[model samples]
Structure formats: structure tokens, C-alpha cells
Target: MPAKIPATVVTGFLGAGKTTLIRHMLQNAQGKKIALIINEFGDLGVDGDILKGCGIETCTEDDIVELSNGCICCTVADDFIPTMETLLAREDKPDHIVIETSGLALPQPLVRAFNWPGISTQVTVDGVVTVVDGRAAHDGQFAHNVAAVDAQRAQDENLDHETPLSELFEDQVACADMIVVNKTDLLSADEATTLTGQLKSDARDGVQVVKAAMGALPVDVLLGQGIGAETDMAARHEHHHHYHHDDEDDHDHHHHDHDHDDFESFVVGRGEIEDADAFTAQVAKVINDHGILRLKGFIAVAGKPMRLTLQAVGPRIDTYFDQPFGDTPRATKLVVIGEAGLDHAAISAALQA
Candidate 1:
């Protein structure tokens, strides 16, 4: 029997540089043939499109596949397994497979998919890498403030339930064979050390934590770990395990529907904007008012032929001209993801106004 092909699962929060790291890997793949499976949370293929635009010879458009049907973990049977089988059956099979999971995905469920009969014998999980935003971690974005949490607990013993973000972050850390603390450049030495310590404590013993700036890491370090993570599922903890069934027979029908009732995402379309500054300010206002976690998409400025790209994590918005509209319909389209119950009508009106 031939050896199983090695595959790496990259999981992280939104805007944690998963795509950047993948781009870096593709650029440095040397002579190895690598296949990429990109999973996105929303209807738009923003991350996948960004990766396809990387212009790397080793990982071209054909090498990259996007699964925007839903979260990869939830659609493992319907989408993930079929995709892996297709990749494995290729006459010119790839030397390795790299899966960039959606920001909202849990690594354990996806890892469990490798245990399926057809896939189990063909591909081995090289490693599970979890990337953490250094700045967000330091700023208590994912419930890092121990003192505050402790005080709240003391005030109300009933406040024992963890926030969705905290649980998600912890689950990713717990399942990681390697934890990459990315965006370290945004943090001071002391801040980085503190965040790293917190992550190390959350990770299982012997799991290595590496610091990186701008998702820069050697290809060798990220791959070839040979972790065989599927067998280690007993040791890796997950927050949603109770909601899952142990029987493989039930997995196909089990959706493992993620509890996303608190989150919402919607697309906002507009005609070409007359004032770029005004549109940006309106976006900032909406983000601030609604506590948006992520906002990104292309925009059509009245006079510019090139498309304007807008990305925001929290209140920080960055804009730049990525490329020409190129005959594609030029319009302002932004996908806003935030807490549920966001007034879409008000938001669209504000942006259009």
C-alpha cells in the first residue's frame, strides 16, 4: 500500500492572516506540487479570490479550490470528503494538500473527517495549525482579561458560561499541534510574551507556540509534522463535542450545525460612490454603531477605473486599489458580519446616503 499523502489544516479567527500564510507557503513551495482547499464562511468568495490573485506559479487558479457551500466542518460529509477524494484520484496527484479553514470553523470536527474509510487510507493529517491575532489577544478581544472575568465571576456565580468567541478560540487552541501567534509586530515585547503565555497554557502539553509577524513562517516549519491527529482525538478537547455523536454511521446525517444564532452576515450593494472619504466615514460609523467584527469587499469609486478594496477589523479600516474592474460589473459590494439583529435596512441606507 502507498503511504498516505500529508495534509495540513490551518484554522484561525477572521483576519488572523491565514490567507497571507498560505500565499507565503505557495510562493516558497519550491518544486513540490501542492493543492489548496479554501473554505469561506460567507456567500462571497473573498478569501478564495484573494488567494487566486496571488499570481504564484506553484499554486495557480487550478490548484486552488473554494468551498463556500458552508463551514467546512459542518459539510464534511457532503463537501469535504468528495473534494479530498477528487484530489486524491487525480492522475497527477499533488504532493501535499493544504486546507485553509474558514475563520469560524472548529478543527476537531474537520480532523475527524480524516478517519472516514476512503480518506483515512489515502491521506494523513500532517498537523493542525492554529493562528492567533497577537493584537486581539493582548487587547482581550477573545476574553483574555483574567482580572475582569474573575471579578465578574465573583459578582455573579451564574456567569459561568463562556462567550462564543472565547469558546471558539479555546477549542482551536486545544486542538492545535502547532499554534502560530501571528501579527506579533503589532504588540510590544511584554504584550507578546503575555499573549504567548496565555495561549501556551491553553494548548495541550508539548504543543509548540511560534511567534510570527505578517504570517511569515518557513514552509518546512508549517508542514511535515506527521502528527496523525485523527488518532489523537481522545486527547484533543472541543467545546462542541457533546453536541456530536460518536458513531460514524450518524456522521453523514449529522450536520453538527454550529450555534451561530448570535452572528449575522449580509451583503450591502450600492452604486458608484461620489465621495470616497464620505463612504469610508459612513462605514466606520456603521461598524462603530453595530460593533462589527469583520467588513470587507470591493467598492466602485465614481472616477476610478480600478476597484477599491475595503477591509476592516473592528474600527480600523484599510483601503487601496487592488486591480481594474476589468469588464466585471463595477459596483460597491460589502459584506458585513457582526452580532445578530443588526439593522440591515438602516446600515444600507446609511451607506447609500
Candidate 2:
């Protein structure tokens, strides 16, 4: 049998900088080919497009798969394994494969997928890297109270009895070989240190915690982590009552439930934003009103020729100009991912406000 190819799974909550970290690694990669499987939370494939825009020369069209119907970790056999097999069969096979699960995904199920039959002989579980939002952690986003709300948001009304976010946080931390505390730039030095200390306390002893800015980290540190699924599976806290072994078999149920009318992604591309503060205020209001989890895209602000890249996860928003628009039309193109029936007209009017 051939040596199993090493693959890394990147898991985190919404807007935790998983995609940014992967892009940085790809940009600074030392000639190693990588296959990126992006599990978008919604029905669209925007995340996959963002990954492709990262300019990784090695990753072709087939190398990327967007599992939008449901979380990839939960739908392993149906969503993950077949994608792995497809990548393996390609003539320009990647030396490494990275799977970025959705913000609401549980990493253990995805890690467990590596041990399944079909791809087990072909691929090895290298490690599970959990990207955490430093800003969010500092604000107690993982606290038990908010965790409860997040849990309710992730599932259908029927699953109101499932495990809470506090448990889910432990599950993610318990299963990780390393935790990348991303978006450190958003936190003060003291805040970052305190957050890191709290994270270390939650993580297993000696589970390395690295502070990252804009998801930038040494590629060597992210890859070849050698955290095999079979070796340290015991260290992970197993959730028995909520998710049963048979539950994996009924993945379609999760998908059907996942398609619930909770979240939707829409773009604002008509006009330029004249006031960043006013636009951000409107975004905050929208989030407060309809539970918008993420907002990201470039805003073409009036009087400023450069495009301002705007991103918001939870209540926190970050903005920076990546590059000049040059010849592209100065239009504000922002994608709002939030609950169903979000007042699109209100959102659009606010953007134009």
C-alpha cells in the first residue's frame, strides 16, 4: 500500500480567521502543493472563491470543494472522503491537504473521518489546527451563556436539547494539537496575554498556543504536525449522549435541518460607502436585529480611491485597505451572512446612507 498522504483540518468559529491563516500559509509556502477543501456555512461557495483568490499556483479548480449542504465534519463519507479520493487521483496531487470546516462545525467528527474505510489507506490525519478569535475570546464569546445561544442558532428548533456551546468549545479545544489565536492585532497586548492564558487553561496541558496576526504564521509550524487521529483520540472529550454513532449514518438529517431558515448571505454592490463609521453602525444594528454572524468584502468609500476591506464577526468589525481599486468600478461589494428575512432594503439603504 502507498504511504498515506498527510492532511490537516482547520476548524474554528465564524470569522475566526481560518481562511486568512490558510491563505498566508499558501502564499509563503515553499513549493509544496496544497489542496484546500472549504466547507462554507451557507449554500454559496464564496469562501472557496476567496481561497482561490489567495493565488496558490498549485491548487487547481478540482483541488477545492465547497461542502455547502452541511458541515463537512458531520457529513464525512458523503462530503469529505469522496473529495479526498478525487484529489488523490489527480495527476498533480498535492503534497498536503487542508480542510477548513465551517464555524459551527465540530472538529472531532471531521478528524474521525480520516479513520474511515475508503480514504484511510490513502490519507493520514496530520493534525487538527483550531483557529480561535482572540477578540472574541477576550469578550467571553465562549462563555456558557453565549454558548447556549450559539448552540440554539446552529441547530433546528427540534434540537433545542443538544449540547451547548461551552461543551462544544471544550470539544474543539480538547481535540486540537495546536490552537492558533488569530487576529491578535485587534487585541491589546495585555488583552492578548490574558486571552492566551485563558485559552491555555482550557486547552490540554502543553497544547501549544500561538498568537497570530491576520492569520500569519510560519508554514513549518502549521504543517507536518504529525497529530494522527488514532494515536491521541482518547485525549479528546467524547460527546456520547448528544451525538450517537448512528447519527453519522443519518447525515442527511443534519443537512435537512441545516437548510433551516436561519442564515442567509447577500451582497451589497450598488453604491460606494461615503462614511465608514455610518456603514459600520448600520452593520452593527443589522447584527443586533437579525443575528448576522459575518460580513466581509471591499467597500468603495467615496473620496477614497482605495477599496476598504471590511469584515465583521459577532460585534467586532475590522477594516483595512488591501490595494487600490485601480480600474475596477468603485462599488461597495459586501456580503452579509445573517438570519433569514434580513431587511435587504434596509441594509441596502443603510449602505447608501
Candidate 3:
């Protein structure tokens, strides 16, 4: 029988640069063959495409699978195992596999799936690489405003017994063979150094700490760690929302001051954003309103022929052109996840304004 391929779990909070890091690995991947599984909590598959379009000649069309099934923390057994089997059965089996869990996911359950019957023989968990947003981590571990604080605190309390960012930071650190502090470019040299020290203090002893911006670490640093999946990761340490088993949730949800069920989701389809500033202002309003938690889509911006991608979680937003939209309409399509009974009309008006 062939040797079981080592699978790495790349996990982090929403918008913490997991996908960016993965893309870097794929493009610069050393001779090792790799397959990727991406799970996006958001409704769209923007992250999946970003990883797939690295222009790395090695990635085949079937090499990537995107799973957006509620929260993987609760649904991994249902979606993860079957998918792993499918990947292993491929004719050109990958030498290694990487699983990027949703921002809201917990790594423990996904790690446990390796022990499941039928699939363990073919694949093993190599390591858990957790990415942290250095800027957010240094901003007192949450957004800087009162509203951001209240929103994060409420989300923390309501989910996983209200796991605070500090605790969540600790949990991600405890379970990792390597803890990568990303977005170092957003911080000054001293700030990055200070945050690195704090992360080192929280990580398991002997764990390596790397400063990365846009997940730019060399491929070897990410892969070839050989951490092994069944390692008693629970011994490393500890750390979501009331979600459903399959698709949509049945419970009425609210976090902070907004009613969660009252949230609204709408797609803004404008072909090629002519003015980045205009689009940025519109997005700023949605996040500042505190009604939106996650925003993602491809933008057809003017002057830039490449497809401009947009992603925002809370007050932080990141954008870059990933690829041309090809023959499709060069319009921007975005999904806004906001509080229950969210004012869709208001958002639509602003986005189209």
C-alpha cells in the first residue's frame, strides 16, 4: 500500500490571512505535490477561487474543493471525511493536503476526523498552522472602537461560551505546531516585535513563531513540518455561535445590540468599480453600521483589468486583484451578512450610490 499523505490544517479567525498564506505556498510550492480543501463560512466561494487561481502551473482543475456548510466545527464529520476520501482516491494523489477551516471554526473536531474509519489509512494530520491578525491582536485583541468592542464581546459570549479574542488567541496558539502572526506590514517594527513576543508567550514551548505579511513564508516553512495529525493536540490547550447541522440555522440569533436573525444578505453586481474610493466608502458604511460581519466578492474595477477581490470582517477590509473575471460580466458581486431584520434597502442604496 502507498504511504499515507500528511495533511496540514490551516486555521484562523475570519480575515486572518489563511487563504493568502495558502496561495503563497501553492505558487512557490517546492517539488512536493499538494491538494487543498477550503471551507468558507460566508455564502460565497471567493476564498476558494483565490486559492485556485494562483497561476501556479502545478494545480489541476480538480485539485481544490470548497465546502461552505454552516460551521465546520459542528459539521466536519458530515462534510470533511467524505471529501478527504474523494481526494485520496484521485488518480494523481497529492503528496500532501492542506485543509483551511472557516474563520469561525474550531480545529479540534476537524483534527479528530483523521481518526475516523476508512480514511485514516490514506491520510494523516501533519500539523495545525494557525494564522493571527497581528494588527487586530495588537489593537487590544479586538477592534478599537466602543461599538467594535461591544460587538466582539457579545459575539464572544454568545459563541463557545463567548470565547474572548484573548482566549481564542490562546486556543489557536496552544494547538499549533507553528503559530504564524500575519499582517506584520500593518504594524511598525517595534509593534510586530512586541506582538511576536506575546504570541511566543502564549504558544506551546519550542513552537516556532514567524512574522508574515500576506502569508509570504517560504513553502518549506508551511509544509514539511511533519507535526503528525494524531498527536494529542488536546493536551496543547483550549477554546461558536448556535448554528445548524446542514445548512441554515433554525434559532433566532442576536449578538451585541443587533438581532442576529434580522440580518440581511444581498449581492451588489456593478460591472467594474470605476472609483475604488466610491466603493470603499460604501463598504465602510456597512461595516461601521455594525450590522455586517462578513463581506466578500469579486470587483470589476475601472482602470484595473484584473478582477479586484474584496473581503471585510468587522472593521478590517482587504482587497487585491486576483485574476480577470474572464468572459463573465466584470461587475462586482458582494454578499453582506448582517444583523437580523437588517435594512437591505439601505445597503443596496448605498452600494449602488
Tens-digit per-residue lDDT, 226-336, candidate 3: 556565755765542332111111012112221212234667666566788678777878667744655778888877778887876445567887997778876789877
Q: Which pairs clash in model 1? A: none
Q: Put down candidate 2 lDDT per residue, 1-353, tens digits, no spaces.
A: 66678898887665676777777677767888888887654444556776676556777666777766554655677766787778888887789998887434467777777777777787888878888878777786753134433542455332224565556666778878778887676889899889878887888764667777667666666786555765567788755423311001001111111122333678877577668888778877776665555677888888987889887654567788889999998887888765356788877676555
Q: Assess each prediction's global lDDT (C-alpha) against the native.
A: 0.73, 0.67, 0.66
Q: Ranking under lDDT, best-scoring first?
A: 1, 2, 3
- Can you tell me which runs of candidate 1 are displaced by over 4 Å? 143-163, 241-353
* lDDT of residue 309 for candidate 3: 78
Q: Which portions of model 3 show Cα errors greater than 4 Å?
A: 142-161, 240-353
* lDDT, model 2: 0.67
Work out how many backbone clashes candidate 1 has: 0
On residues 135-166, what C-alpha lDDT tens digit does candidate 1 reach at each position? 87778684324343333223322222344566
Q: Estimate each model's TM-score.
A: 0.62, 0.62, 0.62
Instruction: Give the winner by lDDT: 2 or 3.
Output: 2
